[model samples]
Target: MTVLVVAAIAYLTLALILVYAIDNLVALFFPDAHSAMPLNFPTLEKMMAASRKYYRK
Candidate 1:
């Protein structure tokens, strides 16, 4: 049981690290692309940006 728990945690940690690295690499190569956001929410970044702009108070 302990071994299985440790293995699961290790697997998840490695997967998260891989995802973070891939995301960084994609951003580095495709600065203009929106691969991080889904197509249905095309303007998600813009909307978040606008919200942050207005919430600066």
Candidate 2:
């Protein structure tokens, strides 16, 4: 049971990392495509901009 739980957690973590990597790659290579979408995940640049704005306040 414990081993199964550990495996599940690791799988989920890897999946999330993969998704984040793909999201960034798309944003990097296809900026116009990503911008045209109505709903999209925040990329690292967006997150960093938000963080900077927050810290400036």
Candidate 3:
């Protein structure tokens, strides 16, 4: 049980870090598209908006 709990915590930490990295990368690569969006993990809605804005260019 203890090991399981430790593994879950580690997995969540990694997931959060990965999301943050991806968010930053998106903002870096698509400044205009991401400028109006909040600085958080990319949800489906945000991704769609960014893609739409990018493709519109």
Candidate 4:
């Protein structure tokens, strides 16, 4: 039925919006929201390589 189709579409749209909002919120608050493993990130050397100095002054 037309009503069922419309309801399904609305449900899908709402679900997509919810997923996107949650993803953005976590990415904004958490430093590494996408990665699942530790030590997968860059080390201090890599940070220095990227010109990001962490001087302990």
Question: RMSD in angstroms, all models?
Answer: 10.8, 12.1, 12.1, 11.2
lDDT-wise, the better of 1 and 2 is 1
Off by over 4 Å in 1: 33-57
> Using Cα atoms with residue i matched to residue i, what is each candidate's TM-score against the true structure?
0.55, 0.55, 0.56, 0.54
Query: lDDT tens string, model 4, 1-49?
Result: 9999999999999999999999999888886755554553576557666
Q: TM-score of predicted model 1?
A: 0.55
State the C-alpha lDDT per candidate: 0.88, 0.86, 0.89, 0.79
Worst 10 residues of 3 by lDDT: 33-42
Better of 1 and 4 by lDDT: 1
- Model 2: per-residue Cα lDDT over 1-57, one tens digit each: 999999999999999999999999998987874444454466666878999999999
Candidate 2 all-Cα RMSD: 12.1
Q: Rank the candidates by TM-score, best first.
A: 3, 1, 2, 4
Tens digit of per-residue lDDT, candidate 1, span 1-57 = 999999999999999999999999998987975466564565877888899999995
Whole-structure CA lDDT of model 1: 0.88
